[model samples]
Target: MNIAIVASILTVLVGLFYKGHKNWLMTWLQNFCGSLFVFSGWVKAVDPLGTAYKMEQYFAEFESTFSETWMSFVAPMFPWLSEHAILFSVFMIVFEIVLGLMLLMGAKPKFTSWAFLLLVVFFTFLTGFTYLTGYVPEGVNFFEFGKWGPYVETNMKVTDCGCFGDFLKLKPKISFLKDVFLLFPALWFVFRHKDMHQLFSAGVRNLIVGLSIVGLTVYCMSNYLWDIPSNDFRPFKVGENIGIRKAIEATAASNVPVLAYELRNKETGHVVRVPYTQYLKEFQNYPKEEWDAEQIRGDQTITVVKDANGRASILKFYEEIPAEQLSDYLTSHFELTGDTTVIPIATTKISDFDITDMDGNEKTWEVLQTPNYSFMIVAYKLYFEEGQENRMVYDTTYTYDTIAIEGTDSVYVERKVADVQARQVSQSVYDFDDDYVARYTEVVNPVLEAAQKEGVEAFAITAYGDPAMIEDFRHETQSAYPFYLADDIMLKTIVRSNPGIVLLKNGEIIQKWPYKQLPSYEEIKANWMK
Candidate 1:
């Protein structure tokens, strides 16, 4: 149907319903839904790629689950969809914002109402699926209620629904519940769309919507195309101190283990689990010989550690026990599991921030503990293909071959051949665009030079990649700072930009700058160094 005809019909329907006292109620509902969507769309628009990553996660989990479930018919398509997640992300963000504006203005109420309902229905399906999947564990069919046994708190494949992007990470259950609640309002709009009130004249409303669409598009594009987010919401954002965070994490991790001791009756081969505290209290008065006669079957301990900064990392520590010495060791150490295993739990989100040099040596702690101010240049990858000229240098080797042949007569003939051997070679030189290298060097070298002049430390960090490529990058760019390796995801979490700069003072992030916004030496000294 033509949009103009739809708009005309919606305008007439809304006008017919406009002569009522319930205008205030409809306006209020419209604004409420409009604001909710606007906020959701705005957060995602600022970091579309972040939403894309979340979409990829959902798609991956869906692909895996679908392959095993009865939904195997559509399993192969999910991976392909995941590959184009960014495109879907952009479409959703724009659709949401446009719908929000239409709702707020009460423009084309009939169309907006139906569109909103359809969108909400789609969201409800996704969230509902996500919530239900949490109960399904590996090796068990999704529909097998008997095999599910009990409600096991298994790890979910897709933890957050990404409904509000990174701004709010709702659990799968909460996301599903939220969508369920939104259904009431969606249905209300479907029936009462005519009661919606227009806030402005038709021309003004159209202009506002047009400008909003253009402005939001430009804003999103600017953030994604050239630099990091204008506002960083990540845990490692500026002003966060890594050293203090680690210290706090360590302090929080110090917890007593909850132990359960298993003892087996050697004669009957019967095993029983006893609480560690009760066992210790009871056995304090019992005979050691009697306890030894009953073999120690298993020992299990559960410990909980919380790091307030972010997610906790669990570390399990185990110890081996000999059957002969189990009783003696348990009495002394008090760390025996049913199977003589000792479990120590410690968790931290910053564990993956571990930095390593190209040689695979850890340098994370050293870098964090440096006394002098440090400058870190993070480039997740040295992203340049071997342009035509250097393609052969990276893949081929030139060699000379000599061959001798006997003629029919008695004479021998020698032949020389210029043989081109096809084998991967370490490319010392790369064919990266000079201007691109120069642009980065111009921004980064001065900062490194300034750090050097002031006796401060500076280094470049990148994800694990070809050592030869890194060496070429260092040489071609004339980088004075040393380069180190870290996980690509870690580098991205540090800063959104490909080649961002982070200024740190004793492991505390003092300032950060995307490539386009890197400050000069004087500017840095004036604004941040003090």
Candidate 2:
């Protein structure tokens, strides 16, 4: 639903009841603004890690922007911010909730107005940067406008700001517009806070706001920081079937009725219509995936077109012209947007959910499609090369002297005198993740063994660490299973733990455990698996 339409309806309702009253407008504005803030904050708090990941994305994009603009000094700051994004995510969640509640109850009108205004402005800036930077040409800095080129959809820095978390999908442009729209009420409350209607007694409002903050803190901690979100909104959430969902999506996407959009060349500003029926028939003639090398070599079997960046490719296959002059026969064509209808991988429940072995063979279907249950150990990273340092140690030395214990042993007696000094020392020991490897060994290893004993197939998948590192981790932790390769971001999405456990039965995710609270396999089998 368009928020603007809802606001209009709310305006009409408020006017119908409280016509001609000066406070009526303020009353509606405050209520609506407070509601939006509360709702947005609440959704984000449900999955705090998702918001943190989005923050990390923005920081990374900003880092790239800084580097592209030759601001090398400013680039380092983004990595630090990315590291603490989760903490910032939690803080922002709580702050938004508290201030929104305060605004709704008219507890601190002046403070809430200022905070809301600042927040909206900051959000507008972020969204504006994301939406506007598309107009900046390739190899051009976003801040430098003189060389800015025509609008290109492919140059967006950050795709979505995650304003409403995963509950709603707002494009970069739409998010910018939404924040811009909120500025009206935010500014009104800033200068005209005196006109705001008061609600509830002072003590009662205090109690409500205090409880809200406490609740939000606990909620964010439990959801992302300490453990997996209680309510999982991600595609890899428990009970999700990757294979089945993709199959279902493919079936649905095949028949989606679509009309070909008119092709427009941004550089030339030339627009042309595509014959809908002709395109609908021709687009279906070729396979949608990568084409054969032979066909792409010179077979006159493909139509070529240049992308928005002026890179030439096969119209259907999107093949780059071979550097070795493999193809000589090529026909140029105009690319049409919305020419064919298919569900984008992004819109589906599963996108980058792939499982590949070290040898580069896909195992996604073989794993998920099996009828028997299996266990997956997802280790996104396992680097711990920097060993513990600055450990306090006592340096002791002993010396023997003939004069010691003279009374007891007479002339030949020798006693040992000890001297001890405290020193800080660094040790290079096992560097297998100081944070969670011990936990994985103590908690997850046992579960893997138990699963093996129960005749269940289990394996490990990781995004980081080479084969040597994997072997070192296995030897150090006594893990006997083989490890496959997977995308790090996807592994994080699979489970919140670095080395989390995922149980699957015939394509459906049965259960997932973060590294912090990995249960015994027997307990899992007796409870969820059985």
Candidate 3:
């Protein structure tokens, strides 16, 4: 009834095809199980050593899962066994070879059967852990039916899984029913254990058995020696492509048109609208997707204009795309909206900010306004003593304040400052801090100043330093902006160059200014108004 049992029974039946029904099934079981032992043992020999080490790690807590009864006897000695990777690997190869050889020679099925069963039992427990921990679903069923049902259910819910010693990273959800549904050969192995001795004859039959086992052993070794299966990631293992196609067909059957829309800069805050089908054809990369095939149509809008600098302006819609397909439209740009989003307000052309603070808190501040006020965004230094000897140090933080402007929101100013700094640091380090900061002050500060003078509202800067320098660095800057910390990955993603400026209105980006050519106040105002 069980799959393994049925498969085993069928395999035995295949071996007995020429024999009559009387002793046919029994003879078939002996040869089939013998072959399986050789095959499984040889397959496992590919990375016997690595497999053993892995076994130790995953099964370290075996005693915790299983009863302490057997653990006190066999488990106590397990952990130390993994220490010598080379020795373990050698041992595994020898073990599998000997086992396979013995199985092939039909040299006492009594010994081979018990040995094979024990090995399978060990694998079963390991696989069980893998399934239970959600590493992988049940791969090779080693147990009988009544005992395996609950085990399969326990693991079937996992969607992403990997076991079989990481050679197979299985999908989490697997058909336990299919696994438990064994064929007859496996069941016959259990039933005809006493008849296993009859499989090997004295001379020629023994020779055939020896040759069969040796051949399997050689096949197993060849698989490892050449590194063949390592590259094959089981592309069709879970039928991923077929399932995706089916899901896509079902979605298409709904007859719902996918919408592609954009927001246009109609001046001021901007407006959301649908673009003409002709405009969509000219601008969209996915124009081939049917727009009117369904009752409702997908829409996408694009706004075109020129900045004060007379540069071409193209604002397009942003939507989530599949990662695999992202390369198809690699040049497409996107914008983020909603509360608590980090807007890039600068380029990677400036000094890299090593925000010592790692907290993901976005630096947000309201520009403090007094009857008499002075405001400036400072590009300040991280103290030399606080940084490493060979590392290049620079101004590590940037601050933008509204102290000079009346009615300035401190909350917004701080938030903007943090976002800008985070974006700067997000760029991977291009140069040392010392070289970068000097150039930043010489090149980027003036542009920042002009933007500040104009009612540009916000700006950001980046610098580098060790975490120990944060307080001293912050105090020395007397900055107007609140410091926000960001991850190295984030900084690297934004700018690959030096310092840059991204101007924002409300929340939408008005322009991106790299340090290559800083914008003048007149230029800033003109672009701000656009």
Candidate number with greatest lDDT: 2
Best by TM-score: 2
Candidates sorted on TM-score, descending: 2, 1, 3
Residues 429-495, candidate 1, lDDT per residue (tens digit)? 4676665686567877877787689887899898898787888888889898789998876677677
lDDT for residue 389 in candidate 3, whole number 0-100: 38
How many Å off is the CA of 107 in candidate 3? 4.4
Q: Give the Cα lDDT of each candidate.
A: 0.70, 0.72, 0.40
TM-score per candidate, in order?
A: 0.65, 0.73, 0.32
Q: Give the lDDT of residue 380 in candidate 3.
A: 30
Question: What is candidate 2's lDDT per residue for 1-530, written digit by digit as tens?
Answer: 44445545655654565543347678778767877888899888988888888889899988988887668789999999999999989999899878777776677779889999999998898889888988988788888889886566578877778888877778888899989999999999999998776566788988998898888999899986578888777778776666655543443444344455354454455555545666556644333342211111111122334445444433333223241221222111123233232223234336567778767789877777667888888887776674555689988888766564546655554556588899888854557665566766678887788788878988888984456666777788888787888887777777776677889887678999887777777688889977
- Runs in model 1 deviating more than 4 A are 1-28, 59-90, 125-133, 136-154, 253-351, 386-439, 465-472
* Candidate 2 runs further than 4 Å off: 1-22, 70-72, 136-138, 147-152, 250-258, 265-346, 386-430
Residue 226 displacement (Å), model 2: 3.2
